[model samples]
Target chain A: MNLKKPLTAETISLDLKGDSKDAILAEMVDLLVASGHIRDREAVLKAVLEREKRMSTGMQNGIAIPHGKTDSVDCLVAALGIKRGGVDFGALDGQPSNIFVMTVSPDSRTGPHIQFLAEISRPLNDAAVRAKLLAATSPDEVLHLLIG
Target chain B: MSGPAELHPLVQFVFQLGVLIVLTRVGGYWLRRWFRLPGVLGELIVGMLIGPYALGRFAWPGLGHLFGLAPGGGAVTPELHAVATFASIVLLFLSGLETDLSAFLRYSVVGTVVGIGGVVFSFYLGAGCAIWFGLASGWLDPTALFLGAIATATSVGISARILSERRKMASPEGVTILAAAVFDDVLGIIVLAIVVGMVRAAGDGQGIAWADILLIAGKAFGFWIGATAIGLLLARRFSRILKYFQSPEAIAALALGCALLLAGLSEMVGLAMIIGAYIMGLSLSRTDLVQVIQKEVEGLHNVLVPVFFATMGMMVDFGAVQAVLKVGVVYSLLAVASKVLGCGLPALFCGFNRHGAVRVGVGMLPRGEVALIVAGIGLTSGAIGQDVFGIAILMTLVTTLLGPMLLAGSFENPASGLRKPEDAAKTESKEIVLSFPSPDMADFMRARIVRAFRQEEFYVYRLAPDTPTYHIRKDEMFFTLECEGDTVVLRVTAQYEALARLVVVEEMLALRSMLHMAQENVNIETMEHELVAGLFSDDGEDGP
Candidate 1:
């Protein structure tokens, strides 16, 4: 349960140019497609969009984690991006957000998902942890800060 | 701070909560079974039985320890109260979220009529009873009158539950009832404010004058508008910030912040925080990220809302009610009669006819959390006597149990004569696009539609707002707009239609008017089919 997962240094591209959420989401999806993790971009996109109808995973600290689990993946999958200026994510705090960390897993793996969520998220609640993670340039560095 | 810290605070708190949860469930469940009221009512009874006022007051040693009872001023804290208030706001916002605004607007006319008429009539009846019975009880007319005035409200939660049980919530009548209940709540709260003002003036030992009452009424109305104006502006600006950050943490913080500010302002203005919460909900209702905000806010209710309802129950004096069960029974009946006759009469004259009248009476019958809230406020103030408190509780109890049974019993036999529309959702599929009929509204929507699309095949015929027949006892704006490729037809009330057509003519005559501005390629016309017009345009972007 306490296995230290590898933290790959990820660059979250935040495009503040678009006023619409769909536009922002499309940019993130394109990044995932380019990364070669997602198969049928449209299908995955629809699945993620549908899951959004269930509940938003967006938390505090200018972040949006729009995630939906599917049976297509056996391993953990995530996409990170940063909106340069920030776009309205419909957050309760009424702040524009630029950071996104979407996670996808097999529907059967609720335990790992919830556990990881609480672990990774504990830091997001603190401003200092976010600054460290967002500023980390390498995956190893990100992991060191997250798991240390 | 003084409690045993041997165990972890988390463990102790959990234990306290566990006891409360179990006690609340048992008492609430049993009360629901016997009293047939909302589970909250039972929870309240049990809380009263266990709270400082009852079991703690009596100090039943073993049971009190097991149930986690404590003496007055020793158990609950301001922090808990704040938590409860927050939960209440979340619950209310959820309630507002559950309301289907589009569906509600369809019968806005009916809802407004029944709501206002029922409240007005019910209020007077309660006041009259307070005067008559109150005078007999040696109270002055004005105080008694205010007391009765406080009774005219129908808490929407109970009525919504009953409607859902009967499966009539989606039915036209049910929709009307639900909408009416929503407005009734808004109106009732305002009335409560007025009464509070009157009470305060009297408490200050000032002479209760008609002018004083009028001033209070004026202030209450003005106060609501003032709060809403400021809240709406702040909320809109805050909503803009959500665009800058999509992070869950930031989003949640923004929502909590706005909720707190609005809630604080509402309290400062002497209004319920829920009112402020509701106003905030309304202001943000139309945003794109509404669903997003909703997802996050749901977490708030899971914990705090139950606490709020539990707190309401905790405020009850169960033993006292039991001691005066006879008076409780009697007062409960009086409360019912006052509500029915008072609300029913106006509904009948307002075109409900007999079944309509009875429907109005039944719809207004279910006493809700509002009654409990009133009693709580009164008891805390100590301005009301034990008898009055007992009567208030009795009123809440009787009304709670009576409404569902009577409505169900009446509507059971379809022929039993309730204008109760068949089922809650019983509606023949009819799609109607509602537009308030006025040249201003018509022209406004028309302009927006024209700007959104420059379709050459656009035609808008003139239709005035809907003015139902004089004898119909209805007041609302209704019109039909038809849009063909280039030609549009509108069907409106003749009088308003004529005015609208003349206005359109005047606009067309002016060079700056839409007619002159209409590009040869752009069909700026009102169409005959409103449904088609709506399907193709942007929300708020394409107007009428």
Candidate 2:
């Protein structure tokens, strides 16, 4: 898995806007499309939602990782969104989720998808890393904070 | 009757009704809103406070003049008493209507045994106490026998009120309690007759009438069985007649009139009037008019039940506090304990686990009007003194108070292994849509689809998501939670249909716990029921 490939300023939205989980997810999906990582927008959105159905992606520390494997995407892709006013994702801890990391990968691949999921989750689990990501004001600042 | 001018019974009744209604409603509201006590308890407390035995004494100069002291130590005027009696019948009628006859029939065997157990055990303890007291203090044997009869009584109304408030009246324990109480009434009537007859014979120095005992038993059984059978058979046809009157009010009136008619019939057949009212209610419970009838009667229940409870409170003197303490406390303890073990043990023997048995026992503890009637009969016949009557009253009050409390506890921590799931889906203001991959790799998942989706607490979300572009299964009649392609969209229903759904939804959650378990590979058993059948499909057919 290439951790550096998807960590671009264009794929990160520091000031995401959405009142609900779907809106937040949509905002992040828009970021991935705008960044030229995917071709079929509808297929990827459906795939992301399909992942959400299996279980809520919302984890502890105000974060959610909504990801899916689908034929619509040619390569592994990622997008991040931060909505300060959290949306309820039916979080396990019952807290509103503010940080969302949406991932789309090709259906033929298994190794990179698993490895990419691990790479994304490792730094997010740390309290200081999460604090820095949450404090970042711009997409550039968020990328620097995330990949640093 | 002794007042300067006998206030026209109507005028006196109006004032009495006004006071009773205000005190009970205000007091019930206060307790329910602030103190969180049961509404019925509030009514009972208000009745006690303002009754002639307490505050009514101070108001005797003016208010008491208007409300005449319960002439001759009995509570309520002849006019008000008549209304309260009607209220009692209405209350029982509602109870009967709510009784699920099909559920009652299912548990009839266990319910009957528990009822018999409750009657026999309570009778022995009560009669033994009376015998011991009689042997030591020169109390009459006839009085002891009468007291024994009183001990066999169980107040279904009190338990029914508390259970109905909690919505547990439809539960297994609730059905068992109702059935047992019905049996208790029948058995109590027979026991009371035989004992009362024996007392009468001994008092007159005449031999016991064998014919009278048989006749009394026959009458109680004949009335209950005959009325219930006839009522059930005629219920649907009677409901059809009510279709001529389209209004809900007309239907309610017809229902209440039937209840009143049955109550009168019950009295004629040597049975409690409420027994007939209850049977009448049960007969009409399955009719199409039941929902409308229930809604109509609810207003009447709110007004009338409070009056019945409050009047019951007014009957308590409390001035006999010291004498009641001397005789009432020990007897009340014995009475409560006997019913608990008696009803509870038989319930367990009949296959109810411990929790269900405890509920049955607690439900039977309250004695209410039935026990009071027995004591009243004993008192009027000169078979028992006023002190024993006071003891019985005190016992009734204590048991009534304790019953709702214990019954509430028994239901809260039911013996069922599963906990009551929170109605999270129901409480959610916004609809939530969940999407998942349709299980295509596993053939086993295909076979279990219908059973897995079969109606339970949770239902599949049928509607397409608000997003217009992403649509699937729009024309399908039944919402199978399946969408186009590999993905399926499942709408969350509040019902927790399976324990496995909880585990599946908390996938990341288990990761934390899995890390704690570190070395051991976790076995996934949730898909076993679906997958195991597929693995054995190729094997030769086994025993049927």
- What's the i-RMS of each model? 27.1, 15.0
User: Which candidate has the highest lDDT of all?
Assistant: 2
User: How many backbone clashes are present in model 2?
Assistant: 1
Per-residue C-alpha lDDT of model 1 across residues B311-340, encoded as one tens digit per residue: 655555555556656655655666677656
Q: Each predicted model: what fraction of the native A–B Cα contacts (within 8 Å) does it retain?
A: 0.00, 0.00
Q: Could you give the CAPRI-style class of model 2?
A: incorrect
Q: Estimate TM-scores for all models.
A: 0.53, 0.53
The DockQ leader among the candidates is 2
All DockQ scores: 0.01, 0.01
* Model 1 per-residue lDDT at A141: 63
Global CA lDDT computed for model 1 = 0.54
lDDT by residue (A21-73, candidate 1, tens digit) is 67766666666564555656676667577655444545567877665556565
lDDT against the true structure, each candidate? 0.54, 0.66
TM-score for candidate 2, residues paired by index: 0.53
